[model samples]
Target chain A: MARDRRGGSPPPTAVSTDLTRRARIRDAGLRLFSERGTEGATVRDIARAASVSPGLVRHHFGSKEGLRAACDAFVLERGTEIKERALFQGELDQPELLLMHRYLARSMVEGSGAAASMFDRLVQATQLWLERHAPSETPDPRGRAALLIAMELGALVMREVLSRALGSDTLSPEGSLRVARAKLELYSQPLLSADAAARARAAMDALGERLDAAAAGEGRPATGAGDPGG
Target chain B: MARDRRGGSPPPTAVSTDLTRRARIRDAGLRLFSERGTEGATVRDIARAASVSPGLVRHHFGSKEGLRAACDAFVLERGTEIKERALFQGELDQPELLLMHRYLARSMVEGSGAAASMFDRLVQATQLWLERHAPSETPDPRGRAALLIAMELGALVMREVLSRALGSDTLSPEGSLRVARAKLELYSQPLLSADAAARARAAMDALGERLDAAAAGEGRPATGAGDPGG
Candidate 1:
């Protein structure tokens, strides 16, 4: 059943025939969980959405919590597969991929232990990707990867605001492309001049040192010394 | 009373002397709202946290909704002031600034009319900042700014996941600096090589054209043509 679901990137209309009943339930669970969050979606809701019985849902996944876990696992696996294809094969226009991204974003926002684990896995993957493919040198590769993941997922989490700003729904194809293009533009070119970045880095380092000194009970008060206008 | 709160970036210990009861309640509201979201924090809770009576809370802000509006306005104004200072004056180490960022992130995640308005204001501010300070030439300056803001605020929203990835609390000064350093590193350099970026852009453009063509009922089905493995 899992293999059937994972085997093909079937069209939405073909989903009914391509997936097993269990896969259908899981897909419904993912959609509801993504849209309404875990607490908002009950077992009956998932069963109804899947056009199955509540008893069948329990028999397959045990409970709502179990169903969520199954959804989490499925999403993580599918997301990894889609991301790998996009990165290595340059296959960027997968429709199911976007749904998976949305699911992951919603899952992370409705945080749980599973979400944290998923985030960590993504960060590790990003860090590895950066180490292998990135042209620029980074002192803290982990932090950079984590930041990148947060920013990307953040866009999904705040899609409504982005859509409002762009006067279109970011989850839609056009808006997604617009966002992607903007991201490409931002990443392909340096936003800050080299000189300014150097100065900012130096200032941050100095501030970090000051913060360290303050933590050590140095001459400056920890919380009050740099009170901008006070 | 409002002036007392806005006048100085007093130390935490001096909060009592520096802010009036109303200001204290507002500040407390901001903290709780930021931490707990709009629904999680209550009027009685805000009053207790501020060490004031519920009657005084009502006298000052009328209701929780009123207090929230007051918080939204105060945060927006203060956020703008801090951002302007940070951009123009290069003062990036203000402690209160982080709290404001936290509050806005929570507000945005909670999603309300006020949150949408605040997001619009932020996008506008970012667009102006990009025009003035960003060296890169962007075809869609609004989209770029909106993306940048989403990414930055997304960091705050997903701070817990980020903290776990970094093994430190991102809200803490040290962790914040680490994240800042990483951001500077990222912003200062192009992640994609010029050749790769050009290729990616070309591919995206081709895909966009195809999507437009498909949307217009040309050569392809809208939903299923590019199903990687199907």
Candidate 2:
């Protein structure tokens, strides 16, 4: 848990040899799962990556699903820890944090109960962050937070395409820095003028009202038309 | 291609019965492919969805891969047409446009050559739009555009989670309007104060220089570490 000069966590290699076998297996699972996804990375692949037998992997986590759950729990816990350190302690340059981000991105794209839970946790955390630091006049704060998180996760999910678009791999340290700088630039200034935003907002409001009226005339529930939840 | 009173394209249902069998198969492919990933949807499922014989589907599109390629081409062409109409003619209220967006989102997440091509096209289009509408002092306009496109597509890719978070399906007309409004609000106002953004930019600059110096000292290519492309 030693902090480097920049207050970031020590590199993974620094403490790699000291980890227990179970911890090693979990770390391997995180890496493989992030890189190859849940289906692409088999138990045999994880076992080989960890320099352990397939049976030992089962002994440690029961099955691939169990291994994934362990990985998910580890990612959630470690990701929160890293985020707090980065936010509160100014440990923002940690490279290992990307692994957690990648794992979560894959999980989110794959979609599962675990992924939904992770996404909800992130939305809640982002909502809290917005309220505390970047408070806004957004009426639907939860929706705003959810949208913001989706945008951030979207970059990770579309990392390959983004990397190509940027003429560099976004996950690399230099490329990561470049992307971060670009985001800082983008968020620092409003993309639309106040007049434009107000006009767009008004237009959306008009559309909503018109749709509601049309639905009422048709004798149908306005919001229930395309409820994917049903 | 008759326009509605609002300047949007006619709804899909209006032309559904007029479509040829080939067109029907292609449309079904687009819908199924968007809902299910490339692997998740099969020729049989697509044929069933289209109410066509599986043999007919094969006769028209050759195979599932061929069907997907045809769908990709159609999405790109139709998406561009819809986008142009939306931008130039104010046809922004078209609900069917969501189908194109969903298909592209799924393709982007699945990551094939087609997906990469589609993403690059989007990045290019976005970069053009930025240059025309919201020019900034960003040194890397391509990177900025790529990030913007990723954020937008990210919303579509994570639509289900976003819908759950917002308590409504984002793909629906009402939910789409809400999401659009939220985006307008977000883009209209700067998320970070100028002072904070400047501070972050300066910090990132310092980090970059430090990393470069470290790389130089180590006699390694500065940007070569962790290059996923390599």
Considering every candidate listed, which one attains the maximal DockQ?
Answer: 1
Tens digits of lDDT, candidate 1, B90-179: 666577877888888877766656778888888887787677677466679888888888888887788888888899877666787788
Query: Model 2, residue A224: what's the lDDT?
Result: 15
Maximum-lDDT candidate:
1
Residue A172 accuracy (lDDT) in model 2:
70
How well does candidate 1 score on lDDT at residue A68?
Answer: 88
Compared with the true structure, what per-residue lDDT tens digits does model 1 show for residues A1-55?
5444333243434544566878889989989888766766788888899977889
Q: What is the lDDT of residue A119 in candidate 2?
A: 87
Question: What DockQ class does candidate 1 belong to?
Answer: acceptable
Go through the candidates in order and give each one's C-alpha lDDT.
0.76, 0.74
Please provide, for model 2 over A1-230, each residue's C-alpha lDDT reduced to its tens digit, 9 standing for 90 to 100. 23322222443454435665577788899999888778778898888888667887998798889999998887777788886776677555566777787888878777755777778888888888777656797888887778888888988888887887788788677788788877876687877777767776776677688788877786432321210000
TM-score of each: 0.80, 0.82
